[model samples]
Structure formats: structure tokens, C-alpha cells
Target: MLSLTRLNRVRSMDAVNDTMIVEAGDTLLQAREQARAEGRVFPLQIGSQGSCQIGGNPSTNAGGTTVVRYGNMRDLVLGVEVVLPDGDVWDGLRALRKDNTGYDLKHLFIGGEGTLGIVTAAVLKLFPKPRSVTTAFLGFRSPDSALAFFTLLRQRVGQDVAAFELISSTALDLVLAHLATARSPLSLRAPWYVLVELASSRTPEDLENDFHEVMQEGLEDGSILDAAVAAAEAHAMAFWRIREEISDAQTRAGGSVRCDISVPLSKIPAFIEEACASVLKIAPDSRMVIYGHVGDGNVHFNPLRPVFESAADYLQRTSTAITTSVDAIAMAMNGSISAEHGVGVAKRDELLHVKSRVELEMAWRLKQAFDPKNLMNPGKFLPRLECVEALKS
Candidate 1:
């Protein structure tokens, strides 16, 4: 029932300190623009930046494309101002490089997903704006090959590599069919593709030389099957549209059993192969729509319903089993069941089966300590009955 949209404002902006105290309701796009206007950059580049609130972002610890270079929302935050459930405001919004006076309380709210309190405002870390940028759409034979090229590319470009995203042929086809402007960037029909972008404080010429050198090496080693380097800013944005519209495309293809998971960077190839196999074993004709931020080890491993399957029938027959199977595969590899996406209603109750007893207990204690009366976004990411009774007792 609470909305922060009207609270949107820039409380303060300290360019010299490379920090900004922004109200949580400010749209991410607005925050980014504010930083850019001041000759700095807010590097968290999620697809929903236009409307996604800055406060809600840290609630789930949203990680988008730039996570390869800038880390997640947790890393970008310096401090937060939270409203406790009992109606007291905790003003911990200190913008400093180091604060060792007490426990880092701001972190408790950053990824709390609204369970702890209301994040009304935050001090966000900003970086020096990139002086040069280049983007490329590349086709690869498989996930393994894409990873190999990614490794080689990183070796050459280092921190200049801002993003490395993996997209499947199936996922791209959905985007092309659903979105009018979406088009394939390369003629090659490889099973895997990567939308890689390089941004740096280095000069334009230096960055361009590195991009060309890495592309040549990838092509020579048979890692890059075909490539399309953006000739202009418009072309680059067009290429990015294909990645951004994937969720909409999935809905048009009929809904999918989505598994937002993450494994070790080295295990991405094997995880994809095993997870796809598991889905097929459950639903033989399900199309694997694999994609995600490869550099950060997160994968959006969704299985689209078979062409002939009814949406209702697909959910009835396979949704639970398919999600459980995919999650198990990720956990077996010492990975997480929830990556960028928070454990909302979809995976809330399922945490019991995956997390350890001690971990669950500690989480419960924190929830009880924060909101003992079970108010403030109750029944989220926790079992309803047990948590209520435990907090009261």
C-alpha cells in the first residue's frame, strides 16, 4: 500500500566525493542521467532502468549487464536511509570511503527485499565516465566456445570489458518474432551468441585497437563464428534492443518456466548442458531459452512451452518439476538458485528445501529482530505460519 514514486528527488550530489544521495523512488534512468550530467557514471545498467526505482533496486540487489565491471547494487551503494517497522527513521546515509565505527547496518537493507525496512534514500557510488565505448554482437558454436572467447577477450581488455552477455539462438528467435524492430545482428546461425561491450576511461583510439585485436584473435581461433561490430551509436542501441526485449518475447511465445540461477564462471557451459537435459527429461519438446550475464556467472535458464502445448496444460504438467530440476542442477554445482531476481512469491517457500538449517535460522532471527509483529511486507521470502509464531514466542 506504500508507494515511493512521489518521493523521487536528488537529496544531494557531491561530485568531488564521487557520491550522490538520491531518494529511493527516483527512476534508475533519471539517476544515471544525473550522474552523467555531472561528468560521472552510475554503472548499474538494468533493462528496467527507465522505470525501476532506485530504492527497490537495492531491495533485491539488482544486477544488470554492467555487473561484469561494476559489481551488483550491493557494491554500488555507500549507505541507506531506512524507516523501521515501528515508525522510526534510521539515518545512516554517510557518504564515506571507509566507516569502521560500527557494524555495516546499511548492508542489511540493501538485499533485504523489503523484509527489513523501507529504504527511503541512499548514497550511491559513482565512477568516472567512460571516454570510449564499443559494442559487438558475436556468434559462437556453443557456450564453451563463448566462454573461451570471453576469457581471451578479458585477457586483452581487462577492466575495459564492461559486459559479456550470452544469448541462445532460441531466445533470439523469440525476440525477432515478437518485436517488430528486433533483428539478428549477425548472419551466422550459431547455437550461442554474445553481446559484448567495452567501455573505458581510455582514449577512443586505444579502445578501438583493443576491440579489433581481440576480435581477430577470436575469429582466428574459431571461437567467434561471425561478428557485427556496431558502426554507430544507433546501431549499438539496436543490437541492445534484442537483449532487452527477451522477457516480452517469452510471453509472446507463451510463458516459460524461468530459472534465474548462477554458477561458477567455469561451470556455465556444463550447467547449461545439464539443465537443458533435465528440462527435456521432464518435457521432451520444451525449447531451451538460455541467456544471461556470462561474465558474472548468472544465467536465465528458462524452458519455453512446446509449440503444441497449451499454456494452462504446460503449467499444470511441468512448472514445479521443471523449476525444481533446474534449481537442483545449479545447486549441485555449488551455485545459487536465485541470482539477480529476488526470492519473490515464485521461489519464496522453496527456500526451505535448498538452504541449510543454520542459514534459515539466522535469517529468521534477523526478520524477528527487525519486525517482531510481522508487519512491513509480511509473508515474503519466508514461511508464513512458522515465522509469525516464532517471532511472537
Candidate 2:
């Protein structure tokens, strides 16, 4: 994961009525938390909340830490001020919900990953603070068990299941070994552990008890091997720290080619099985660390070199093969190669491999319409193509 970019001048508008304009340099966390301080909450957050800029979030259409309920950053944004490729401003900054006055031009730049323009400022939507919250840490005997547990919990909690993160034993081991204060939430070893959080809009509903009751049923049905519910606010923070630290722990372990992908919810169990098998078939000695937001059907499938192999050489040799195999499996299953992580430079070619020629042409036309000079964050999303006449010239 790319670390947060440092902001030179983070600024926010002091407007009233649940609306505010945040400068490009401001981090999503900074903007949202500041909005909350003014008695409103920005309904958007990304994984690198501490450093990831608002410009990047809206550019990549980041769906982060609370995507299950709040949706992506795209959903939270009302309007954006963008500088076009040729240095002209397109001021489409109206905070209206239903603006059919003309073509919806803002959609082009939202998920363009900055290829269309540089997002200068944005008017973000804010929601009322959640009344009550509950978070639980759960352990499962296997990946399938975790998937089953997700299904049961979603049915019970409905959309209140804000986040359901899966963590591997290898992943957890790194946290315990590398991070000094990290502690295991469960006493026994299991193939996978899940961190779940529930937030409610109402007061009378006890989401903690509701969550505990569901986990109890899961244990009785042999789905959950063990569980630990956060007793206090500090404990809830402790449980979340584990999930948040997984990426860092993984980095310290060894050389890894991390893939963030999504498949159908029903096929998650099968996708993991087949994808890992295919990887091992090619690179038999590779160590696989599988974990992700199972409830959202996204996985961070990371492959690391075995302890005996030279990490640099391992990555050099198997990098292409790993990507090819995994992407092929993703296509066969009607899944996505780049899920939450947008196709920056890493997977642009892979995207072309899966997308149709007509689809690519349509995208190119849209890009041309918005960014004629193509000077805005070039070489990020689609491959550049010259017009037939321009090529002749």
C-alpha cells in the first residue's frame, strides 16, 4: 500500500448546513473529523486515513474501512472543483442531489484516478453521528468457516454489519512477532480470525448483545471456533488495531506481491481454493497469506517467498507468473483483478486484457472529452492512444 502523501496546505470550508469544501491537500480523516467537530460527520474514510489525501480518495473513488454501509467516497461527494488538463477550471460545485440540468460531468473525474483532472476541492456530504456501536473479534477453524460465519452474521445484523475483516494465522503471527504490544485475541490457534463491527442508527437496539447472540449460535452450529467481544471502548480499539496493522506486519515478513481482488460472495470459498492451488502449481514453494473484507467479497491475496529462498530472486522470477495465473482465475470466475485498489500503473494492462475492445474505445472517448491534452495525471489508468489522423500527422 502506498503511504499517505504529505499535505502542504490542508484547508476546509466553514460553511453551514452539513456542507463544506475541503482543499486537495487535506487527508480524508482530517476533513471528516474536522467536519464532525462542527457537529456533522463526513461519511467517507479510506484505509490510509491518516495520510491519504482527499484528492486521491475522490480520484481513485476509494472505498475504505466502512464501505459496507457508507458506500465509497464517490457516494459521499456532492460536487468537485477540478482543473482540466489544459489548466481550465470546471466548476461543477453544486450541492444539489438531483441535478439534471445538463450531462453529469462530475462522474468522469471521480474514478478516473486523476487521469482526467486534478481535484482541487470537493463538497462532501455529512451524516448524523451513529447513536450506538459494537465491535467483535471472532476466530474460525478455516477460511470456509469464516465465509459461513459472514453469511450468518450479515443475515442477522443486516446492513449494520459495517466491516468484516478476515486475518490469516501467518498474518497474525507477524503482528505478534514484529509488533511488541500486539496480543492474540484468541487463546487457541485457528486458520483464520475475523474482526467485525456493528453500528446502529437507533437507541433501543443492543447491537452488542445481538452480535454476541449470533456468534453463540455460530459456535453451536460449529461455524465459529472461538470468539471475544470487546468489553469497553479501549478493547474495541485494541481489536481494530490488529486489522489495521495487518498490512504493515505483512510488509515486515518478506517480499510480497499483494493482490486486492473481489469475487461473488458465494464463490469466495471456492475462489480461494482454486486460486491458491493454481499459484502453488506454478510456484510451489511460495507462502500464501489470504485475508480481506469477506463480507464485501474483496480479498488481499498476498504471496511471499519461503524462508529458504532469496526474497529478491523469488519476486524477480515468479512475479509475472503469479499475476497471470491469478488474473486468469479472476476472469474465469467473473471477478475483478483490481477491486478496491484502483488500477493505478500496476494492473492497467491486466485491465485491458479483461475488458473488451468496444469497452476500451468507449472509455477512451470519455477520456478525450474531459482531458483533450491528457496532461492530468497521465499514465495512470487507460493506455494512451493517438487519434488516427493525429498518428498520420
Candidate 3:
């Protein structure tokens, strides 16, 4: 965790906008709230907001729940300050949205995952905060139904649909069982559930009526079996907690095999079905807990526990097989092996195998130009020179 309690320095150009100089230690939430205090808001929001430093977020180019509206961290940044692997500082922190001067060098650092340079500070973009919001929890029979509802809701509601998160029954059960205060919204357990939120900068926009109407249509069309709309801010937070608590509950549950990948929205249903089928063949009694941001086509597809085997053994043995199985399907569908989480060291090889040759060359060139010695966050994201050299040999 990088230190973000107070930005090392901030140079203000205007009352609402300024160029902030932050160390690699600054937390994104601190940066966001600091900007908000001046009556401006940074559009980016991610889980681990408190602990995830701006440098880390920028390096990973992380996207959070609000990505459907605000996009990834790359979109919210204006400029960056980096220390080259050779120990030279590249101070390019500018508040201007467009400089058009030369190479947009910031891109090389933003999602580089710390491989090229050490991000010391950044000038970030800010926005007006929304005044009104709405939340809805809808239950579905399966991933197909959840996906169908997502399509219908998006078609009817458009960009106002800020979030469309899917939750599996097994995931919900873990939360309820492990989280002492957690409970299911509906009495019945459906195979899947969707937690949706709508927001706008303008207040008194009557989003609730629009939300209710779309959900009603969803219910009628069989896209949803039941729905629970949040009437107040407290209720909205309560509903959203279920989605937020998933990672924690999952950890408490047991050893897990996790993949964060995306396909086209239309292909999501088939992706889940085919992926689950493959898992079942390998681990017959494995509990498949698949859920995530359906609107963005990403899924936190995890397989945990089989009735017969120990959790430790299952994870150790199935790691390779699971990777091959998931990657094959994602590649076949013209989707990404990593949607938002990024490759880091975890998915580096998979990226090499799947990315195009031209794409790989361009990336490597950028890496060389930015940090020839490669002393930034070494052994992460892109492949090492030896790996590429070996490939050629």
C-alpha cells in the first residue's frame, strides 16, 4: 500500500481543478475524497479503495463497479509523474485533458502495472457528483436469465444503468453463512441474482419510476422472477453489500480457483454454460460460483470444493487444467483472458499465448522505450526479455 494520507503536493490551477502531485503511496479513495472536498469528484471507484494506492490503480488500470459509466482508471487520469527504472523522475503531471504535444507518454505508465516505471504522482480528472440514485435486486433462475434481464434493462434504461452485478446462489450462501448479519432478500433461493444501480448528476430526475417500469417489463418478459427495489439510501447500501461482500465470503469459504474474464454480452450465457460443463467433467462435485458485472461482460468465475476431495488437493491439481479450459473458451469467443483485474504476474503467460504478434511487438517496444533496464515492478504484467528471446530461439 502506497502512502496517500496527504498528497505530497498539489498545484492548483483553478478552484475546482488542479494538478495533484502524489507519491506512489497515495490511496485512490483519499485522492477522490480530497478532490470531492473541493466540490469535484473523480469518476473512478474500485474495491479496496482505501488500501489500493493511486499508483497501484494506475499501474493496474483497474476498473470497478462503476466502470459501466466511468470506465477504467486510464480514462480518469490527466497526467502522471514517474521515476524511470534507472532512477530518473519523469514529471509529466499536467491538468490539461489535451496537450497534443508529442507522444501521449502517460499511456505507457497508466496500465503498465509498474513494469516500465514507478508512478510517483498524477494529475487526475474530476466530475460533478450525482444527486439522486436508485438500486434494485432481481432474482433469476440461471446465468441465461440474469443475462437476458441485463439486456432488457440496458435497452430500456440505457446508460442510467450504472451497475448490473450477478450473484450466484452458492456465493450468496457463503455470505449468509459467514457474514453474521447477512440475509437473503427473497425467501426463495434462485440460481442467480442481479444487483443493479442507476445514478445521474442531476437530482429529482425520477429514476425510481423509470427503474420500476423497466423491472416490471423484465418480470413480465421472464427476464426476472422477482425484484426488490431500494426505497432509501440505507436500503440501497444494504443491497449493494451483498455484491461487495463476495470476495471476503469467498476467502472464508475455502481455497478457490478464480478467473476474471470477459466475453461479448450476448456470449455470456453460453460462456457460463460451457465453462461450467468443462469444470464438471474434471471435478464432478465441485461447487461453481460464477457471478460479476454482466453489463461489462466480466465474470468472477470461481470453482470451489468437491464433495469427495480435500480443498488443498483440488486447487493444487486443477490449477493448470482450469487455466487451459477457461482460456480456450475465452479465446474462441474473441474475448479477453483478463477483463479488468489485469495480468500482473498471475496471467502473464496466458496473455503471451493469446495476444497477437503485432500487439506483442508494439507493447515490448513501448516497454523498452519507457524503461530499458526494466527495474520498475519487475517480473509482472509483460513477459521478461529472456522469455521473448527463448520464444524466438
Relative to the unseen true structure, what is the C-alpha lDDT of residue 23 in candidate 1, on a scale of 0 to 100? 97
* lDDT (0 to 1) per candidate: 0.91, 0.78, 0.78
Greater-TM-score candidate between 2 and 3: 3
> lDDT per residue, candidate 1, 1-393, as tens digits?
889998899999999999999998999999999999999999999888999999998888999998999999999999999999999999989998898998999999988989889999999999998899999999998999999888988898898889999999999998988898777998879888999999988898999998898899889988889999998999999989999999878987875998899999999999999998888999999988989999999999999998898978997899999998989999999999999998877788778778765677778899989999979788787765464345444
TM-score of 1: 0.97
Which portions of model 3 miss their true places by more than 4 Å? Answer: 1-23, 202-205, 390-393
What are the clashing pairs of model 1? none
Which regions of candidate 2 deviate over 4 angstroms? 1-17, 386-393
1 or 3: which has the higher lDDT?
Answer: 1
lDDT by residue for model 3 over 117-148, one digit each (tens)? 77778777766666678888888888887777
For model 2, what is the error of residue 369's alpha carbon versus the real structure, in angstroms, after optimal superposition? 2.6
Q: After superposition, how far is residue 279 of candidate 3 from its true place, in Å?
A: 0.7
Better of 1 and 2 by TM-score: 1
lDDT, model 3, position 300: 86
Tell me the lDDT of candidate 3: 0.78
Ranked candidates (TM-score, high to low): 1, 3, 2
Q: Residues 146-264, candidate 2, lDDT per residue (tens digit)?
A: 87877887888798887888888877877787789989888878888898888877662577677778888889987788888787899989988888887887778767878888888
